[model samples]
Target: MEDIIDKRMVDQSEMSYTVDILNKGVGQVAKKLLEESSELAFASVEQKSTADIVHEAADLIFHFLIMLKATGLTLNDVSEELESRHKN
Candidate 1:
């Protein structure tokens, strides 16, 4: 799945696509993530199982990567920031 995502991202990048396309894609992904997160939050309030929360969290992370790619950033950049923050 990651490989497929990477390939699509590379193809999009190589095509010199417009920022609008990226923005739209990111916006949609953000909406989905927000919805999922809200559901997860509500589930927490209702004392739902950890498994459900974990599943939603994973969905959020996956969408986050799509958002990052849409913004022309790579996972490596995010990883580097996390590493730097860890050092601090």
Candidate 2:
């Protein structure tokens, strides 16, 4: 006996999907940065290896750029914040 499968019965849209919920023009970059930071936190709790953490950190930085793009900010803004903190 042979079994039959129906592909047409599947609803593609019902499947899980990921979407960036941030606004397209201004908040996207910041949203991505926040997402990356969350991932880093998760990785730390999960006890991921050092190499993995490093890679995740890199990803976080890249996402930060996206966030800056979204928020109309720049690396200089972040740098200035860091500088002020160092003085304290």
Candidate 3:
């Protein structure tokens, strides 16, 4: 995903939806994250199929990564924080 973002940012010739969304800026990305998370939560509450839940979860994680990139952070950064908290 990081590679996709970097490549798309450098080469505009390719049509990548992820890049398009990222280009829309953090506000849009955050909105997607919220939407996806809501869908996931509602799906869980509605007792949707396992596949449906997984789909929503993937969407949420995708937007989450985009948010992290926009904010100049990474999964490692989040992991480090989690590790520190676990040790406390």
Candidate 4:
């Protein structure tokens, strides 16, 4: 998924709604993330199955990646931070 996003970010000729939102800047990515998070929060207790939570979580992650990319960050950057925090 990271590779896909990375490739598409440069060659944006095949722009989809997600990519369009990404082009709009960090705020759009953040908005999508917040919306997804709200859905996931409600789904956590209200939804009987884990499917709803998983679906929302995936959306959240996708938007998060978009936001991260917009901010000139990557999953490896996040992973490094997590690893450093773990070692502390």
Which of the numbered candidates is closest to the native, going by highest TM-score? 4
TM, every model? 0.63, 0.56, 0.89, 0.90
CA deviation > 4 Å runs, candidate 1? 8-24
- Please say which candidate is ahead in TM-score: 1 or 2: 1
What is the per-residue lDDT of model 4 for residues 1-88, given as tens digits with 9 covering 90 to 100? Answer: 7887888877888987767988898887888889988988888879647887898889889888888888989999999999999899
Q: Given candidate 3, what's the lDDT at residue 32?
A: 91
Report the lDDT tens digits of candidate 1 across residue range 1-88.
Answer: 3455677655775553233345477777677668867877787788778998788777667666667776678788989999999899
- Between the candidate structures 1 and 3, which one is better when assessed by lDDT? 3
lDDT of 3 by residue, 10-63 (tens): 798886877788889999999999999999999999999999999999889888
RMSD of each: 5.2, 14.0, 1.4, 1.2
Candidate topping lDDT: 3
Task: Please give the TM-score that candidate 1 achieves against the real structure.
Answer: 0.63
Predicted structure 3: lDDT:
0.88
Candidate 1 minimal-lDDT segment of 10 residues: 14-23
lDDT of 2 by residue, 1-88 (tens): 0010112113333331111322344455555667789889888899999988898898887566555544556677988999999999
For candidate 4, give the lDDT: 0.85
Q: In order, what lDDT does every prediction score?
A: 0.69, 0.58, 0.88, 0.85
**Model 3 stretches astray by more than 4 angstroms:** none
